[model samples]
Target: MAVPDPRGGPAPAARAGRPRIAIVGPTHPYKGGIAQHTTELAHRLARRGHDVWIESWSAQYPARLYPGQQRVDAPEMEPFPATGYPLSWWRPDGWVRLGRRLRRRADAVVVVVVTPIQAPAYLGILAGLGRAGRRAAGPAVLALCHNVLPHERRRLDEPLIRAVLRRAGAVLVHTDAEATRAAALTAAPVRVAAMAPHLWTAPSRRVHAADAPAAPDRAGEPAGQATGEATSALGGPRRRLLFFGLVRPYKGLDVLLRALAAGPPDVALTVAGEFWGGQEATQALVAELGLADRVELRPGYVDAADVPALFAAADALVLPYRAGTASQNVDLAHLHGLPVVATSVGTLPAAVSDGVDGLLVPPGDPAALAAALRRLYEPGVLTALAAKVRPPDTAGGWERYLDTLLEAIEGQRRVDHR
Candidate 1:
């Protein structure tokens, strides 16, 4: 059955006469920063009464090809009904059909672009929309870029990303560093939209209870647990360091483990989130270093709903990435009022004000990471850093983002008029 357009033509009652936009991307149940941003973007735009429609994935990833456990977790809330349009990653036919459906349904399209893996699919969709008549009120594509390209230092990824990015009406990046990298991709107008703050929007002091451990106490140690650091008069958990998110080779987990080996033995580290390729190697390294117990590894895809608990349980968010642009994890840390400790690679410094919000060390330097970790574990360091963190201003703050997107769309509209 062909999915009928949910909104039958532009209704007279749409507030301010703004166009109803359709958001297309991976949504809820998917465990990752990209999925979180897509869901939140839809929620924020929808609250604006602009008639937002989320066209989520019919099948996000094939099982054999997927590195993680699943494409998405079991849906917590009601699932968005299928538009009766299903697309295969390998086949452009389905994307062509879906693109036509989207052009008819929405005045604008916000496509959240992740990896180059999905480039062909997105490009096919764009081609279909382009053919739907340039002057027609077809959906305008706004590419919300999480990363300009893959982080594994692939030269081809740049061109691959640029090709699809150029096809879009507008591109949205998360940080200044990313803007620079993306600028090299295409002259297409790019908007620097900060990633949404926090793991989940509503901030709460109450410890998020999940399968993960609860928030730690003033002793710099986890609550409801013993054997970690104990508070001395002033409430503080034992110094806990976290390297959250997926474990991939480029993420520099091995460097972090080596740093842990070099750092104070008492300073415990938590390596949460699932492993993609280097699990055995990382685990073997941990045992080789005799720091097996010092490092806690929770290797599995963490559901978005469960992120709060994992974040709250730690004292700081650490990113030892070898290469990459700004991380959504840093934004989430700031939103949760947690400080960060990261290497000087990509736009980490852009998100963190060293000695202010968190600390920054040289990328791939274990000694520097060790020193940084020691400083963070020192008394009052975590609390002081946490105090410096202010929740990111995301709500109603997409002016730059909206302006750039409008310019591209309107420019294209004019070209079509000619």
Candidate 2:
């Protein structure tokens, strides 16, 4: 028998025993940190004895809107068994249909919200779920907000975010700062869940001094002057620093280049990952700063198989982001047992315990950033920081994260029942 509600549609049937959970986000075929995080969470949840299903996008973005080369990466070598549904982003009808199916099948649905661009699709899906809930109790909705507000903002961002958040039963954020921001936007209960390292395996190869590349020659400069402070620290080879991830305006790559130009001439840098805003300006900046020889730029998405070698070659990872709520790159650095030199913004202060696992400097200050880079070569500084670095599992493991998520779900359920 079905229960009746104010809207007058047949109510969804209530279930007993273990909960059926569905994750609505990008996974596997999709590339980037968010996709990897979503896929990893689904596997961890399934391992913890829950019936899990993942609802992934058939078409995430139109090519015109996406600046990257490809939408999906090559499938991961070790794949997780997920019942992935290829739902189109532009189809409201498909959103509603999937929502209705999820309402009937699952006890809870976790939605991963990263950008405001997808709010329209989510709006339609939630609307369908709301209608189903009014007739009969529908699955509880949990919004796992990777970013409550995007790094870049536009006029419609606020209204769109608020509308989508209102439809969620609970909101999960990575930091306390984000929790406060989410609370200000909606009345939805917000939970703070720490982000664990995304890398599941350690690097197989060890980078040796012979593997280091020689620093490029600076134009119109004598060989002795080109060697700079870095040569004095190490007589053998230049130490490598990695500036990784998607190149965006907010990421402060220009700041890093300026710092590199001013810092010791003995250090070399590798800029990996695809460029979002085009690489012309960055390349121009590198040449203008006379860092052409010192900086090696690899423009494109890095495959999963090659990540370990990249990390193994660097002495430290540098993130000079101008603004951010949280960073998964910090976690990745720690997971790889490498020290990080990141700006003190968003959750970075909490992520890198200044002088412990990494060093923190004020954002957008080239001199400060350069000083921090120099400090990495100081006696025992890098060794001390690397010694404190802990694997993500040991730091706050996946089990703990899953437990926090379940608690949020149960808490929301109790409030709804009341």
Q: Candidate 2's residue-wise lDDT over 1-418, tens digit each?
A: 1211312244344435446777888876777778767877877676666777688887887788787865544553234465565467778798887787777677788989968888888877787677323332577889999889988889999899888887899899988888998998888799998885555332133221112122221222222232334433434466778888899999999999999988877788889989997599999998899877778898998776677667766777899999988777876676566778999999899888899878999999999999988887776777777777764453255667888899888887776677
lDDT by residue (1-418, candidate 1, tens digit) is 1223443443233345466666768765555666655655555455445566666666777777576765554543233343223555656687777677777666677777878878778877777777323333465677788887777746667677877877776678877788887888876677776554424422233222111122223334332133233221113334456788888888898888888888866666777788887788888998999976667787887655666656666677889998877676886676655788888887787788898879999888888998988887666766677767876555434444455555655565565456
Any idea what lDDT model 2 has?
Answer: 0.74
**Model 1 spans with C-alpha error above 4 angstroms:** 1-17, 74-85, 131-138, 153-156, 201-238, 396-418
**Candidate lDDT values, in order:** 0.66, 0.74
Q: What is the lDDT of candidate 1?
A: 0.66
Give the per-residue Cα lDDT of candidate 2 at 67.
Answer: 71
Cα displacement (Å) at residue 411, model 1: 4.9
